[model samples]
Target: MAPGPIRVAETPLVSYLLRRADDALVLGHRLSEWAGRAPTMEEDMALANMGLDLLGQARMLYAHAGEVEGRGRDEDAFAYWRDERGYRNLLLVEQPNGDFAVTIVRQFLYAAYAEPYWRAMMASGDATLAAVGAKAEKEMAYHVRHCAEWVVRLGDGTAESRARAAAALTELWPFTGELFEVDGTDRTLIAAGIAVDPQTLREPWQRTVIQVLAEATLEAPPAGFMRRGGRSGRHSEHLGHLLAEMQHLQRSNPGAAW
Candidate 1:
């Protein structure tokens, strides 16, 4: 039987879905910032399209979460009404999309996390989540491949490109810990079968990261103290700046429907 949208009953399921969706929303917003700023026209289109895909996925997940919450909130309501402190997205996604190298590194790192997370989630006890996870798996598969190829190409391409990509990867590496950190809510979901423990994907994700870096001729940065706290709604200063730009028009013209 073809899977359908996720249907969740527990609040943890609602919270977890929102967390994943919000993660995508924030990252997609970052990519959208590159619409015309990318190094080349083709890359610009590619980034924009990728942003669109992320946005679409975010909307779908957010809508499903809203239904689970049973609070009559829609996707826009959930997105616009929540404060930054209320958002559960990780700090990694909120990092600014600086250069092409930086963008590729961020995408490569996040895509690795997204792949295994959703793949395991395809079997979520919640029916809708399973379906959403299954479909998202296909889309995210391409994102991983595209980002991986760029990482390899740039890392092995030229002196300048290699340095830049390597630097980007190093800067982005530490934030990755947040992806597989299972907090309290996750414990609840794990017991209930509504969510997969983030730790479960740790090994596979590491293998993916390691293999891709090897192919890219990139060295893994040494383990260092990671800066955490995003899942707690405590974000880096960058999130507020990003929200201001993203919500500028909406806040300025309240309820102004296009």
Candidate 2:
């Protein structure tokens, strides 16, 4: 095992996988909270399926992250053992879903951000990274479809639904910025040809999201400084509560496993 030459760190790949896993895990957990609370049976199925897709994405990304970072942990360990400080998830994913509109808006925005990130990452020199992106692209596309459909339906349906959707967008649109800001670690990846420029992903993400909203008869939230700071782990207050719930068993019974 010690026969290889010196290996440079692939921090971008490692960081990318960690970010992706955390996003999926947090959002998937949010969606799962609505398992039986959706307004209708069909909506329950839709949300549940989205949750499954995100959870599946989380597992793959977390497993890859553990491999690349040599963390000696699997997806479950990473997910269940982390305290709030150790989690790298975005704040938006942990927001409580107050209504169907909030859920739709949140999912749509995340899918909008994820789709392009995955599409561009499909070319990573790392075959495992590229393959993971290739597999996730399809699922992410479906997530966009389902959320976009809900966007249109809710936006164009009834006055109440339209207002609700619009309100949801107003609150959720700001969090979209987290997916685009490239930091020091991100710059390394960009220089190494292993990661996309997060700055560049913004325009396409906006165009596609706007087109979907336009078709849905909804307008963009007014331009302004959107909420930020999720990438550096300065999460909103909800993260503590979420981690407390998610990590309780792990903290209570160290190394307990099924």
Candidate 3:
């Protein structure tokens, strides 16, 4: 028999999980933009595969979120029905992919943080989260390595390549702060042992990023003002455009599944 819809009250945990899920979904869509456009055939495939990895992570998290919320909503509902203001992804992930260097730098910065974040989440008290983390940790590790190599290659390559790499770093650095920002939702989940403290991941993320920049022969941007608010449903103009594109097919033909 088909199970009836569960109806648990919405909680901070639902918000927390949605934040992570939105991050993956938005970033995966960003990466998918590189399909058929990468510099090389091999690189094109690589970017697509990584995008799939992130989408897979989003699916798991979104499903878990629906279960927790007991709203009978599935991953498709969360992915397609939400508007720009409804999304809680980090601002970093939704930024435009300007160039190959920009894309690589963005992925590296995100993957560096994601690797450690997922590793810590492996210890989450929630069994579902722990299982998700176990799978995500492995994928994030590969993402870190793949993007880091490109960062180094671009930064240490020709004069033009190095310049582009440097510019990309400067442009994206401000968004990194949101990755480690903690708030009330985080606090509640931390108390329940269901969430990894974002603060705890900052040190390792900095270490990995700094070391990679050094190896790439690029200068790390000085820390100053950092952007925030993605967690609160605020986002850049880019997100609205992205959502419109991504949701168009689903929105246009509602319930018209094959």
Best by TM-score: 3
Give a tens-digit lDDT track for model 2, residues 176-214. 767777788778877888887888888988998999999
RMSD for each model, in Å, please?
A: 5.7, 5.0, 3.4
lDDT of 2: 0.81
Candidate 2 stretches greater than 4 Å from native: 1-12
Model 3 C-alpha lDDT per residue in residues 1-258, reported as the tens digit of each score: 433223334489888888999999999999999999999999999999999999999999999999988878999888888777778999999999999999999999999999999999999999988998999999999999999999999999999999999999999999999999999999999999999999999999999999999999999899889999999889989999998899887788775588
lDDT of 1 at 35: 78
Off by over 4 Å in 1: 1-10
lDDT of every predicted structure (CA atoms): 0.84, 0.81, 0.92
Write down the TM-score of every candidate: 0.93, 0.91, 0.96
Q: Can you rank all candidates by TM-score, best first?
A: 3, 1, 2
On a 0 to 100 scale, what is the lDDT of residue 51 in model 1?
A: 84
lDDT of 1 by residue, 1-258 (tens): 332223334477777888888899999999999977888898898888878878988999889988878877678766765667777898999998888999889988888888888889899998888887897777778888989899999988899999999999889888988988887789998999989888888888899889988998999899887878887779999998998787666566655587
